[model samples]
Target: MRFFALVAASVMLLAVAAAAAEYNVVDYGARPGGRADDSAEAFLAAWAAACNDSSSPVMRVPAGTFLVSQAYFKGPCRSAAGVVLAVDGVVVAPSAVDSSAWIMFHYAHGLKIRGGTLDGNGHAYWACKSKTTPGRRCPHGTTTLDISQSRGVSVRRLTLVNSKNAHMAIFDCTDVTLRGVKMLAPRDSPNTDGVHVQLSTDVRILSATIRTGDDCVSLGPGTSDVVIRNIKCGPGHGISIGSLGGEAGEAPVRNVTVEAAELTGTQNGLRIKTWGKPHPGLVESVTFAGVTMRGVQNPIVFDQSYCPGRGNVNCPGKSSGVKISDVKFTDIQGTSATPVAVRFDCSSTNPCTGIMLNNVNLTYNGKQAKSFCKNAHVRLLPRVAPRRATAYRPALPCQLESRPEIRLVGLRLPVLCLPVLRLPVLCSCYACPSRASPSARDRAGDPTAGPAPPSRSPHLLVYTHMLVIYFQDILGCGKFKKLGLQNEEALQKCFGDIISVGNDHWSPHMVHGAAAASPSNAPNVDGNDTQDIDIDLTQDKATCEEGDTNEVEQISPVNANGKRPPRPAPPKAKKQKSGTALTIQEAVTSMATSATSYASTKQGKYSIDEVMEHVIACGATYETNEHFIASELFVKKEQREMFMTFRNNEVRFSWLTRKYMAKYGN
Candidate 1:
């Protein structure tokens, strides 16, 4: 009974703390319904009060349209349960443009922004920019919600629309979760990326429906462990890893997975793009699985030679050095607007490796799909597009010696040695029988020869074996003739420099005296048609000390294995083939003419015209509704509008015309 009383008392104290922590904007002099001096200040004051409370706090904004100007809710809250900004009200942005963010949540932990409409009045800025001709400039507005440098933050059930720039920019944060977020913008709006995550990790975006001009979910440099699931993105550039490696000293994006996504009428899908400049970073372990695309222009691509804003003028042909490896695309069934279903344009200097395409069935124009690859090692499963895929195999395995020999101590009696090429030691031996009557080789050679007693020579007791090692390649450094090491002196120097351990307690056989054989005229294994072979050793040299006898002499051709050392097989030669080798001018001309002229030749049921019409129709329904509502307010000749009277006794109008009428005249 005493323990039950203690539990009840603790529960009562928690309830009392929760009640004391509640701060409502109505009690703080907030006037909703489009008041000029709106609830922006009052809402901020309530957030401050609730954030300072020791218990879990709730700052509630009741259901009403609250006109707010640039407000920032800053926090390092004292609440253990964090501060919940339970906003059921529609927070509308002011028409007065500023360089500051419309709404920013900065430095907050355990923060939750939920249940509201964040309306950025971007129509005015879009109109001002639209009216500007050449040489005329218009000031652009800021992002809708700039949440930066906060950990353990969640923004849920929020409708963010008409952002001046990116809708929600999550920067330099960790453990951010955004669920059931709807980001809406015009398809033609410039630079309105939906959810941009940069310099952040462990970000999860679930059940998001994004319609915008730019990428739906863009992961910039230094982003990793990002999971995007159940996303429906359309009328935008689809999810992208980067336009990375644009500048020097940039961090790489790694371990990003986007699964169960449906992209309709998107410009691109599942893309990883790096700039044409050089960056010494790496993008690794990215997976795009269970993605469905409807009329996506480029369904899968890895463009290491990406130059976004700059067109094909003076492209320099310089590729990014950011090594992208271990990327996977699985279960991606889609239709591409263009004939090229998948393109992998990797770097020349830093070629991409370990790219896997599994169960990818993309079609173009009702015909079997095709792909284009450049400087990347790609593995494709049978279900992938282009049923007849000639997979990329490396031209050379490893620079190995043709005839490798090792030194072993010899006993007077022959010992049986088995071939151990695949073993670590490379040679194995067994003790010979001591009771043999005659020499085994002589007895086997002559039928008339009788068995003789085995000679017990004490001199054949034992010999000290010295370990001599030889290796063709270690790590990536080897003798490639293209690097200009051809002479005997250069070969010796290369061996001594490259194949050495830290200590000199042992001597490597190949390092001191080994000569490369004359390279065959046959082509090497690298996919290119080059005739030059890198490292091919033919001879081995072993030295014996003075006390070593004739039986245990160095450089013997035969061993106990009784098998002759086999020569290394020559690399199979293959010619590098390019299906589409056109210059930029030709590509541009082809793109312009391909739509009209190429449509007639398409064997598919839907023509290019039909595909484009379908793509445009995908976004027209929502865009049309938004345009219809926006046209009534942003008219050149405006009539009277309904004005709302706030509790602060301020009568305010809710349209762009309201600001225009107060400034100009009707």
Candidate 2:
């Protein structure tokens, strides 16, 4: 019994010793030198032994500079406890390498890489490319460290420098964490991105300091649930989501959070760029918060029309189709190197929607910065400092400007300038002296005729004539004549080449006789009385006669002298009762059906108020309602006014409604 116990104790001790095995590269004939010997074989041998060990194995590189050439550490190791690659020395890549990656871990799982300095030695490659002619291409060189098709990977406390391309790339991996990783490259080093993550999930990059020419951290397509925090980036293109949409059927990138990042003197801080081509991919639910930018050229940017080739030789003229929505930029305060600090040059086809800017204070040269938005629906939360320029040019006759003093039901409203409709109604009573009769001219001199009709301003008349000619081309000559405008030749001469007359169906002589003989104008032409013209601009000339005259008399009261009394102020709209609003799903479903029915019957034409009510009924949430309207409905050129109206009213919707509409309505 005593002899058996001694043998068992010896076996247990041996097993314990095997469990903590270590494989050293030096033991595998690795020499420390710049040119004496290549250490790639020795490092591979060490990794092979460590990986096959059933124990918790570690492959170690001691305190020396080892030169390697395109080493690949392939995995599916026998070690159940995983393998650790710990280096206390420097691993240097040869100046002239052919492979795309200097050191790559392929299909590696449960891998931990800690405490290494990787020197890419990329100066030669960069210099070679710089000397190459524009038409010619040079060797693209390699990424420093790449981990592909791996899982449960942790890279910590590593310093990577001077990479020919990206310093570190995480591709097609899952459950990866990079902590305390420092990457350094010259500011002028082309395409030296610090960390590039693509087709990966659950990636956490924390406490990283990156200085490079390209993006410090870039998240490509199919990347989701990424958390990037505590990053210090400078002299680089600050963290970017893309230059995506280069191909069709790309996967959507969603649920990315980047917070507590500081960017200094970078080309851009927090940018999402997509190519100007047709792509079905989208970027959604991205949050950039608590970011501090110092002298960044563009603090916040969504460049959907990204054409980066020299001379734009390969530029795609078509608008981008990638949908970017529900992106929030919060608590971003900094100084901008350029005056336009915040730029949203989104795609005209798939305009960036549901963009919220909250508590963003960006300054340009110690003064207020400006924001430029094109085809982007931006919602400014309280305390957004950068003032938006009139960059979003809507295809409408007049741009709506918000006038807080103009209230409807106690809500501040944007005042739409309907000068074409209002000017004719207000100035109709000012009869021409040549047209008016002698009695009407005498009545204009009477003090008791209230005040003589105010003389028309020459400038106003010219402006009105221009508007008439412009709308005449748009609404057709029939509608133009129905506006009761005279002196068609004068207006055509005044506008001359500026107005393109597309409608040749109606002759000016056809309307001139009617204008001269109309009973409504006879009294005004004779100048017998300064009576208000009761023309209903909203109705057609035929429909205007059908309108109740008694209702018009009640609305516009006339005195005994045949002069209209002072117009009564418009009645305030009653405040709506706070009834139980429908849930987002209910609102969207109801609105989808209603919009489809309305579109089928009316050719999708809607009044501004009708569109506003539709958006309101949809509950105004970007993800559910606003996105639906912007992307699915109101996207036609004829519906553009409705789109602009809803945007001016600050009504929002959702992008998810596309599918909902597809399922529930046309």
Choose the strongest candidate by TM-score: 2
Candidate 2: residue 535 lDDT (0-100)? 60
lDDT of candidate 2 at residue 251, scale 0 to 100: 65
Please give the clash total of every predicted structure, in order. Answer: 7, 13
User: What is the model-wide C-alpha lDDT for candidate 1?
Assistant: 0.61
Candidate 2, poorest ten consecutive residues by summed lDDT: 506-515
| Candidate 1 segments exceeding 4 Å error | 1-16, 308-316, 384-666
Residue 536's lDDT in candidate 1: 35
Candidate 2 structure quality by residue, lDDT tens digits, 1-666: 999999999999988786458898999989986655899999999999998987789999999899997687877788766789998999998887664567888667889998989999999877875674765555645778888667899989999999877788786679999999999999988778888787789999999999987789988777899999999999898989986785554568999999999999998899998877877679999999999999998888787766544555545575888899999988898898876677777886787888877777788798656555556656544441232221111111221111212233333322212111100100111112221222222332342333223345433433344333222221122333343344445434422432111110000000000001122322244344766566666667557657745354555667899998788777897876444444665788999999998776565444444444545544554554344544444444334342332222211222122223222221
Error of 2 at 588 (Å): 79
* Cα lDDT, all candidates: 0.61, 0.66
| Candidate 1, backbone clash total | 7
How high is each candidate's TM-score? 0.56, 0.57
